[model samples]
Target: MSELRRFLEQLTAAPSAEALWDLHCSKMAEYGFDRIIYGFSHYMSETSMGDPEDFILLTNHDPSYMELFIGNGLYRDAPMVRWALHNVGACSWRFLWDEMARGALTEREKQIIAINQRHNVTAGYSISFKAITSRSKGAIALTAREGMTQAEADEIWAEHGSDIVLMNNVAHLKIVTLPHQSTGRSLTKRQREALEWVGDGKTTQDIAMLMGLTSATVEKHLRLARESLSVETTAQAVLKAAFQNQMFIVDGIQG
Candidate 1:
């Protein structure tokens, strides 16, 4: 069997988000993209990508770079990020260079470029996945190793861009199917059970009887789920949990 086929099979069967990410990172590294940043949101809007806490973010970029780029909100002004938000398919970094050469970048965008250059994140490509929902968006940036020029990255893309986009699309689809809760947003088993029941249109009393708990206990679990998800209502909790793939999960695959 071909190596790509083997990798796709492994990717399809990956048991957890972390395992899928590890496989993807190694594969991209072989194509000269040693640093990667992937982000997806199911709750995007006209003005926002929803709360940062709710995003499914995977990256192997340096923590310091990520801190300022994402943590500090510099990505909002990043030229590539703006392009990813507005377009789909693979884009070469030369697009950014061209924009800079034409003096079209805003001051904030220039600052983002400056930081990226300092961290050797100068050469790469971005792939914007087709949105699965009207409000959903997903994109990834693949950064070449230090010292590689945009010309070199473009050459690699010219040869392997189609395969790289296919692999990333598959990985993104698999990741969305897996649970991806943030640290403080994880629900207890009971909370998850309660929310799943709620998603199935169960009343509090019905969930209590099904789970062998009192109605008040079920209510408490449902309440805690809302709190954990930082949502206001039980229905919202159910929706959020489902969005994160954290409800009705298979027993062994709970990650």
Candidate 2:
């Protein structure tokens, strides 16, 4: 319990999502879990998970494998992912295959399983976090070290399951509060201020007067902000920046 508390303290100090993922990977490795893929969806519905753009996916898997698994949409039928989409709480991957005997898995699911096995991704546990909103949920899948059979993996988890669950949940909680480079947007201070004014319902002329800039310069800042955020309009830029948690942030949101 003390160790978990210390880890939580360290977790909150992570400077960015990438740093958090790195710490999480090393921490999970200490418990014989060597790989993980964590995902958080901000916009979801009963029918869909909303735009892929609205989700955060972090993994240490090989790029080639992810190209096929995620890039190709094969994750749609991945048993653990499917489980997370529908449920909250942790479950063993062993339960995923129980459906095979019951003939509940689709042909596509079977193929994905076979592919996973070839990659030594056979044993793992899925933890689907409690939803923060009706349309938002997050989850993580922890894969045991290669060469460990399900029995061996289960043995390790049995001994440390409580700590693992608590640590991971705390990590997720800390992670969501950090800023993400979603959309790869890096707004300059001026661009950010421009968007902030726009977000506060200011027009170009108003922002120009407030910032002591010409109307043309204010428009330029707004245009650059839009391009940096990959949006077509100033309003969209503000919304996207807010979504990435890059707007309206006070200094030291993270310690």
Candidate 3:
């Protein structure tokens, strides 16, 4: 079978966000994109991309670069990031140079450019996935390995850009289907079970009977689940857990 066929099969069957990301990074590396950063947000607004804790972030970029770019919120002013927010296709890094030539880059954007230059993140492509909802956005940046010039990167893209975009779109689709566990947002097994039952329309008494616990104990579990999910009610917890793909998931079955 062809390499792309094998990759598609593996990606379709990938059971977790981390495993899917690992497979995608390896495949992109074969095409000379050695470093990648992907971000998605379901809580995006007109002015913000929602809470940082709610974002699904994956990357293989340098730790220091990520600390300033993502951690310090430099991505808000990044030229490619702005492009990704508005467009739904692949873009070459040459666009940044054109913007610079036209004196279009702002001071903060210049600072971000300097950071990328210092880190040798000079040549690359950005792909913005088609948004499925009004408040949803997803994008990925593929950085060429150090020493590869923009011209060479563009050459490779001219040949295999379609395949790369297709693979990334598939990967992004599969990623959202898999579970996303963010910090301070993970529920325990019992907590998840309670939420799942609530999602299935079970009452406190019904869950207590099903789990062989007292009604008070079941209530405690539900309360804790709401806290873990940072919601005020069990109904909201169920919806949030389902959104994160954490409700009713079979943990080891996918492994």
Measured by lDDT, the strongest candidate is: 1
lDDT of 1 by residue, 158-208 (tens): 898999999999998898999878644678888998888888888888998
Q: Looking at model 2, which ten-residue stretch has the lowest summed lDDT? A: 246-255
In candidate 2, the residue pairs with backbone N, CA or C atoms under 3 Å apart (3 or more residues apart, or in different chains) clash, namely none
* lDDT of predicted model 3: 0.89
Clashing residue pair totals per candidate (backbone < 3 A): 0, 0, 0
For residues 1-255, what per-residue lDDT tens digits would candidate 2 score against the true structure? 687778888888888778888888999999888888888887688777766655777899888878888788787778778889888888888886788889999898999999999989999888999988787889998989898888887888799888889888988887778777655557877888889999999988999999999999999988988888777977778877776777777655422
Q: In terms of TM-score, how similar is model 2 to the real structure?
A: 0.90
Compose the digit string of candidate 3's lDDT tens values, residues 1-255. Answer: 998889999999987787888999999999999999999988889999887777888999989999998889999889999999999999999999999999999998888999999999999999999998899999999999999999999999999999999999999899888877665467788998888888888999999999999999999999988788777988888877877888887866332
Q: Which of 1 and 2 is ahead in lDDT?
A: 1
What's the residue-level lDDT of 53 in candidate 1? Answer: 80
Whole-model lDDT per candidate: 0.90, 0.83, 0.89
Cα displacement (Å) at residue 57, model 3: 0.7
lDDT (Cα, 0-100) at 234 in candidate 3: 86
| CA lDDT for candidate 2 | 0.83
